[model samples]
Target: MNEIWIEKYRPRSLKDVVGQKDIVDRLQSYVTAKNLPHLMFAGPAGTGKTTSAIALARELYADSWKGNFNELNASDERGIDVVRGKIKEFARTAPIGGADFKIIFLDEADALTSDAQAALRRTMERYSRTCRFILSCNFSSRIIEPIQSRCAVFRFRPLRPEDIKKNLGQIAAAEMLSIEDDALDALVHVSQGDMRKAVNSLQVAASLGEKITVELVYHTTGMARPEEVKQLLEVALSGEFIAARNRLDDIMISYGLSGEDILKQIHRTVFELDIPDYEKVRLVDRTGEIEFRIVEGSNERIQLESLLAYLALVGENRADSAD
Candidate 1:
């Protein structure tokens, strides 16, 4: 019933993590040896990097995990002073409760500035005996090479749909909510393999009603229904320019969707169309260009209408060739 289902249902131990089996098995090996090298976890957001770090610390130190583990977000204090002050003070200190070494988790380590990273490398070297570092980032290339060389890098991949569904299903049962099959599919579509986003979407949908339906999920998430989006494309492809543009206006206003959002949905729908492969390729290419224009501050309405006009033209051209 808690509002934040993601954290509420966060796995306490690494074994409970939904995906990343190989990473979990390797981390368990370190736990068995009661030793760990400096580790770098490179992955996209919401892929259990923080959970793994917390779970590792707990498994390693048991009751004293809190005392022996220190977690800091580098994005909040990404400067040389933070590296020298808080990081150094923690690294140089001895572990409490007779533990061999303390663990310092630096989340978003890629956000640290070059000067701060240079300072951190020396600190890491100086405190090797008393401290081990776990650096988490979205991109490993942003981290300096020296730091990369010092740690064993583990890359986390996006969760598969089945894994995300399994996790969400578990949450649904625990919360005593009923979810339709189509609704689950919608969650998967919107989340794009992000468990946190899926769970959060479910939580928001649940608050709106007792039964989670496909409509509820899309409404809560501010995304147009897949069927509606596909229909829009179908109408445009039929060369009904005025009708399709009217439908586009309704979809955008009703869903409160931005131009980019609609474009992304259209892009996905393009591949699903029964049209020829060549046509799909051309549509995707044009979609990318429109996306770029929108990003550069062009009027969303004008660009979207232009796309509809193009689709109508494509339809017209196809009719001519078939004659």
Candidate 2:
């Protein structure tokens, strides 16, 4: 807790988790039954998939949780060979107590290859008597159907704004950092439902000074302030191509944003612009095309520079047509 907040502040029990109430209630029922089938947790990053897995293990195993709880990240484990090897090792022994089975938590499980997942599915069947598996993944669609059918899938939603704010307030009180009301709101907005990001931002901002402000939050996260992004779009729409290009370069270079990151901001900011509705739609569609190219490994700086020029053209067209 002294060194890092995310790990230190991670929820230890089901009740401690902030959101996903229905899933928590279901998990609590599993605890009461003293039995669990395979579980698949599907959601975006920074939600409580991993946390719920650990909390369930703790609830089930009491004093001997660590020995019975085995955690493996499928993204790092790579191939079927490694997966089989680790499962064999963990499942070899009976659980330490009279409990019916041990638990293996495979995090980021959607990263596994088809072959690897097929092998893992077999492993799950073979060990059904003595072991249970809980898989956590960002997207459940990638998980094979055989594996899906075996598990009770739970979809985790991103934390609500109030949930994030409550956690931030507790951490600030505990850590004794001074964060303003608006600054806290900004943190929540930037996190986009990721509690891990919100907590990390607070910790990073705290490192710079005792008083954490909105400016510090934006600077520490390397995100262009919303207004800066809005202004960049405004400049481009006003037909100042060179200045807008320079500003875009500064934002990407100074803020460490990928082309995708900058374009996402542009897409959102477009809706807030004074431009006509049809033109707003056109810019957003163009942003999507460029973003796809960047994702396919195009040169980011060149693509973004060209995008500014396109905006300049759109502005001129808007002026020339003169509705």
Candidate 3:
């Protein structure tokens, strides 16, 4: 059995891809023409950006795709010199297999420095006849305007719940297990639309050799159960300071979640609470501040604990005011 479902089931052709149908259709047009222009794929991680780029190359070059396609992660290289060096080396030889231009798929292209992007723009122009560039990043805004204008840009959204559900269902059946209803719900909720994460969590649960259940999925994925998160809100909002603090600790320690991670989930959880919209906005504002502090190197535990305390007070004051 293949250990890594991600690689085992990665889409080989554009049609095999899960969602993002409009982007797939546009890419297929290029495949039919056998002519790909410089392209940019912008989206969150695990959304099939790199997969689409590779699949396009495979469809275009057939058996010789391996020789003609180059893959690079801009984050791995320390500087633009490395990018320039690699591009020079790859372009030294004409594309193999009678293809018009070789392809260099640069993953995390936004990580490249501004100076690097500038150099890259020139590089793309210099090698337009010999190579095409496919840049993928989470934020297209980070990429320079010149680079953005040069290529066909495709924006990828998070996979829909149905898309994730159908794919995971197929994978679960293939593994020959009876998936509990809650397992799929927990998996989708925890994954937050990252298909890679959803598939990976499913694989981890299957490795335990037991029926996949909600608790097991949460344990395997190191995620706090939605109910637990809800309860945390309940405890905090009800002004149970010690209990709320302890619950926060349990979630953080048990799940190995960072402060920012917990805070972001709390923000999501706040919206689900049966609180007034005004109270929800207040809690979200506090969460936003703490998240920033955690990211900016403020002490994680201290900051989050403070936020919980504030929520407790807010919940109390709001409850009393309603009376």
Candidate 4:
């Protein structure tokens, strides 16, 4: 099996992890002190939490870091039994290189049950001297209070477009691939501040050995290209509601696009449509509201259909008023 690009290209040191400068700076202080707290890295996926933790372990422990670091996924083994047993086994040993403590990196800690978390809390206290725990989760709220209280929490933000572009440009030069300017921008836009997604898309495009284009990024992300989305908008503007709705359904099913993904495409496509500036702004504002509602457990298909119908009405109104 081919190794996944995300893992293969994961940042090896703190300097290589992009974005989150404040968190990195604070972490550097901890490394300098040779005294680290239990850490809770709360952030969205693909934003370098795990990578930073591993990097820290490697930096602090040097050659024998592997034996001193234990990494586990809480979601994969969801019970306290495995966690308790592993911690018991790993924490029993002293640091191989005479460091103060070994490191245990627990990923997806939010997946643990409350009972499991309680058990984990006791484990943290019991092994406090021998092992430092770095817990990572998408949401900090799901972690139990006692567990949360023990750690220094760091919130990681999504990478900005500039950061993503800089990293992608570096990778492109190293991989010997040429990307069109617009295509690079499209990749950054589609990735939405996730560097891992940006790199993976770049790697896939590079494998094809062609100058990366906007259409390629869209296909790689399984979203309709901006041009196709604009085409659908034009059909809506012409008051061909049935045709436009049909096209939306076809695209969703063909590409497996989520409701949120469609909304993002619509938001971008609106600016490209030939419409009054005021109308474009108004439509996008309404689209944002509909997207929020869909995310909050509203029926996705119905919410999206409502958005399309509203766009069609606006388009028809503009046409009639113009006439």
lDDT of each: 0.94, 0.90, 0.88, 0.85
Q: Which ten residues in a row have the lowest lDDT in candidate 1?
A: 1-10
lDDT by residue for model 4 (1-323), tens: 16676787677877777887898888888878888989999999878899899988887888888989999999997787866788668876788878999998999999988878988898889988998999999999999989999999999989888988888887777667789888889888778788888888887776666578877777777877777788888888788888989999988887789999888888888888888899888888899899889889999889888877887888788778889
- Top candidate on lDDT is 1
Error of 1 at 276 (Å): 2.5
Model 1, global lDDT: 0.94
In candidate 2, which residue ranges exceed 4 Å CA deviation? 253-258, 296-298
Candidate 4 residues lying further than 4 Å off, grouped into runs, are 1-3, 234-238, 246-264, 267-307, 314-323
lDDT of 2 by residue, 52-71 (tens): 99999999999899989999
Over 162-200, each residue of candidate 1 has an lDDT whose tens digit, in order, gives 998899999999999999989999999999878888999
Total backbone collisions, model 3: 0
- TM agreement with the true structure for every prediction: 0.96, 0.93, 0.93, 0.83
Question: In model 1, what are the clashing residue pairs, if there are any?
Answer: none
Model 4 residue 28 lDDT?
A: 82
Q: Given candidate 2, what's the lDDT at residue 7?
A: 90
Q: List the residue pairs that clash in candidate 4.
A: none
Q: Give the poorly placed runs of model 1, Cα more than 4 Å off.
A: none
Best by TM-score: 1
